[model samples]
Target: MNRATLLTLGVTMLAPLGSAYAADDVKVVEKPIRVLAGIFSAASGANKQRTAIGVGYDFMKTAATNPTVYGVFLDYNSKKVAGVTTSLTGVGISGRFYLESANAAGKPYATLGVGSYTLKAGTSQSKIGGKLGIGYELNNGWLGELSSTMIQKIGGKDPGGVTFGIGYRF
Candidate 1:
């Protein structure tokens, strides 16, 4: 009889502790502003490599497996690709979906972005383009990603290349 009473008391005491742990598995956020700034290393379709700096912010969040973010950013790429002199100024809307567990180690995410850009290659011309990439979010509030962006109407070429970036989520 005494053993049964102790077992019942122990179970009652541990149940609430287990429940508290479950609640901590998810991040409790009350509206967050996401911001990131990173440098882009790109290889254009013209077989040229260029570098650019980009900054972005996400103003909306949707609940699914985790928090999904959507916002906009600006990018500027140098015009020195494959010995061709040119530059690109771009502005676009971006979206990211976070998949996996969100914790101190953060999670993995995929991104999609669309924008309009002006290419300066002797003459200034405008085009519509987009970017796609995959990245990992670190627990230290930093992000690392590899992306590809494409532009239209530059020497009959598509300027899409891989970009490696490191930034922050705030």
Candidate 2:
């Protein structure tokens, strides 16, 4: 099976877990205002290259005493090709788990999630990945993050690779 198919299958297998969150209260939130742009390197076996620019957004969510955050994000990327170029577009749900720091300042965090990726190779796919980042919270309810991810490709022609971006928490 190809990556997209595997993703769909995996999500299908995990459909029951969605019900667990039903007991939790659902709330709407907005986050701090910030943006980040950076470059990412990707390698499949031995062929590797770096993309010149990668972009991401941070939509801050409600910050409790524990300072958890939730938001939506989108990312775009491109790969060099001889005649035509290949590209990837990803959109998914994102969140952060914070570690309380000394002095009551913004804390460090780690995040992970799955999303869909549209590739130029004729198939749009869904992928699962994990990320780790360091973040700081300013006095004004603003949070900034720098993180990286390695998405697993189940069915695409290319093996999954790494992505880097920034985030914000309100």
Best by lDDT: 1
Q: Which residue pairs collide in model 2, if any?
A: 2-155, 3-154, 3-155, 30-60, 31-60, 32-170, 106-137
Model 1 root-mean-square deviation: 16.9
- Report the lDDT tens digits of candidate 1 across residue range 1-170: 13344345335433433444465443333334444444454444442555666777665555445655666777776746556776677787776668875443678998877777777776788767777789998766777887777655466755556677777766
Model 2, 1-170: lDDT tens per residue? 24575456446433433542454533344433345445444545322443533333444433345544555556666666665555656666556556663237556666544566555544456555443456666545554555554566545345345545443433
Prediction 2 TM-score vs. true? 0.57
What is each predicted model's overall lDDT from 0 to 1? 0.63, 0.50
| Clash count, one per candidate | 1, 7
lDDT of 2 at 101: 38
| The best candidate in terms of TM-score | 1
Candidate 1 lDDT score at position 141? 71
Query: Least lDDT summed over 10 consecutive residues: which range in candidate 2?
Result: 45-54
Residue 24 accuracy (lDDT) in model 1: 48
